[model samples]
Target chain A: GAGVSQSPSNKVTEKGKDVELRCDPISGHTALYWYRQRLGQGLEFLIYFQGNSAPDKSGLPSDRFSAERTGESVSTLTIQRTQQEDSAVYLCASSLVFGPPRETQYFGPGTRLLVL
Target chain B: AQSVAQPEDQVNVAEGNPLTVKCTYSVSGNPYLFWYVQYPNRGLQFLLKYITGDNLVKGSYGFEAEFNKSQTSFHLKKPSALVSDSALYFCAVRGFTDKLIFGTGTRLQVFP
Candidate 1:
């Protein structure tokens, strides 16, 4: 794809339900990131993946939030037992690579999740 | 830890006037700065970035930013504002951890 792509642009789920969001990064990108944006809030880092190394999950808010990436391609973010506070826009971004000075990151449209 | 701060929640400027959006950052090592723009219901779009070299970095859409190492600031600037420039702007910093930390963002309203 020309840019990062996310699926299910909009989602509404019950408070106790689980939701999975998918992301497809640009071809050849070796770095992927996931972030969440609450209403009127800045983007919050969630997880990061670089190659086959263990993902940087330091930013994951809680055990309920988990993400995985296969190789350097598609990634998935799963939020279990969603809470009302979990309602937010989930964004995905991919960069060419990661190093001391990272390259530009291309973002996806994001998935708006509403936990009712 | 790395962090970014955008003090102003919103800025209003008239068309053809100079515009500025303030940003400050804290990091352990040399800071790599970036500016991104967001329209309503849309993902962020990269504007410019400052890595190494000149303090003044020019980017897409006639936007530029100046990096001040001493002040720990990277402020976005446009000599002549346009109403079409009205949107949300964010400042980010890449720290020693190799992760980008974004600021709260500032909404720029360029009125005609």
Candidate 2:
């Protein structure tokens, strides 16, 4: 794809329901990232995927949040037993490089999840 | 740890006037700075970045930012503001590692 693509642009789920968000990064990009943005708040880092290596899950808010990536391609973010506090816009980004002085990150349109 | 800070919640500027969005960062090593803009119902668009060259880095959409080492700041600026430039701006900082930390963001409102 020419740019990062995310699925289910908007989602409204009841509290305690599980939700899955998908992301497809640009071809040949080596790095991917997930972030959460609450209403009127900043983007919060969630996880990072670099190739087939173990993903950097340091930013996951809790055990209910998990993510996986297939090689260097599509990635999915799953939230189990979502809470009201979990309602936010989930964003995906990809970069051509992932090392020091990394280049610009191309962001997806983002999935707006509303936990009612 | 690496982090970026955008102190202002919002900035209002008149068309054709100069505009600035302040940003500051804290990192362990040399800093890699970036600026991104976002419009309503859209994704973030890359504006510019500062790596290892000149203090002033130019980017897309006639936007530019100055990197200040002593002040630990990288402020985005434009000589003239346009109403179309109204959008949300984010500042990010990455150290010598792969991690990129972002600031809260600043909402820029340009009036005609």
Candidate 3:
């Protein structure tokens, strides 16, 4: 079976510029999530999208960080006016469904963003 | 808030030797525990998870973890180590929220 995939394996952008990272979840997955992994740190939850429901944006560090998933397929995480601190690996994951007994999340290779 | 802690920043073990990576969690109600491994320059790979039922949960690549309810811990363990098993391991917990809270991570180095 095909696993999750992400585009732009690496991205380098100016500090003030905006960058968009894309994620393609596995087929038939109904839930998708985005997270940020900084150097020497743990993964920070960014956002979550379930089929037809309002995305959970509680983990977004600032208003500049936003994400959107169309239906139950691809998703895009956009960082507006990127900052040096925004440099990190953006990872995406998806599962069959979200639950009390949550399903395992399959991850993508991730997009490494470097804000210079 | 829900959180996880990996006490050791790094663990070194010789190949064919047993290895253990510690993880403790704090969360309200019953916790959903997970283990993930990351190779350098790559994304995370799910190892295993402890949702309920058994105390010991087996996962991919001959790895397993024990979920201790009273101790609030879910420590990853392997009976024998392999050099190829070296990587960054993370313990995560999902509480009442939809998001998963991850620990700082533990680097495992298996030397031949």
Q: Pick the candidate with the highest lDDT.
A: 3
Clashing pairs in 3: none
lDDT for position B106 in model 1 = 98
What is every candidate's C-alpha DockQ against the true complex, given to 2 decimals?
Answer: 0.74, 0.78, 0.86
The TM-score of the first chain in every model comes to 0.97, 0.96, 0.97
Candidate 2 regions with alpha-carbon error over 4 angstroms: none
Whole-model Cα lDDT of every candidate shown, in order: 0.93, 0.92, 0.94
**Tens-digit lDDT track for model 3 on B25-52?**
9999999999999999988999999988
Give lDDT tens digits, candidate 2, residues B2-93: 88999999999999999999999999888889999989988889999998989999999999999999999999999999999999999998
Tell me the lDDT of model 2 at A57. 96
Candidate 1 per-residue lDDT over residues B26-48, each given as its tens digit: 99888889999999999989999
* Worst-scoring 10-residue span by lDDT in model 2 chain B: B93-102
TM-score of chain A of 1: 0.97
Write model 3 residue lDDT over A19-96, tens digit each, in one string.
999999999999999999999999999999989989999889999998989899999999999999999999999999
Model number 2 iRMSD: 1.3
What clash pairs does model 2 have? none
Q: lDDT score, residue A66, model 3?
A: 88
Candidate 2 per-residue C-alpha lDDT over A1-116 given as tens digits, one digit per residue, 9 for 90 to 100 = 48999999999999999999999999989999999989888888899999878899999999999999999999999999999999999999999977754777899999999999
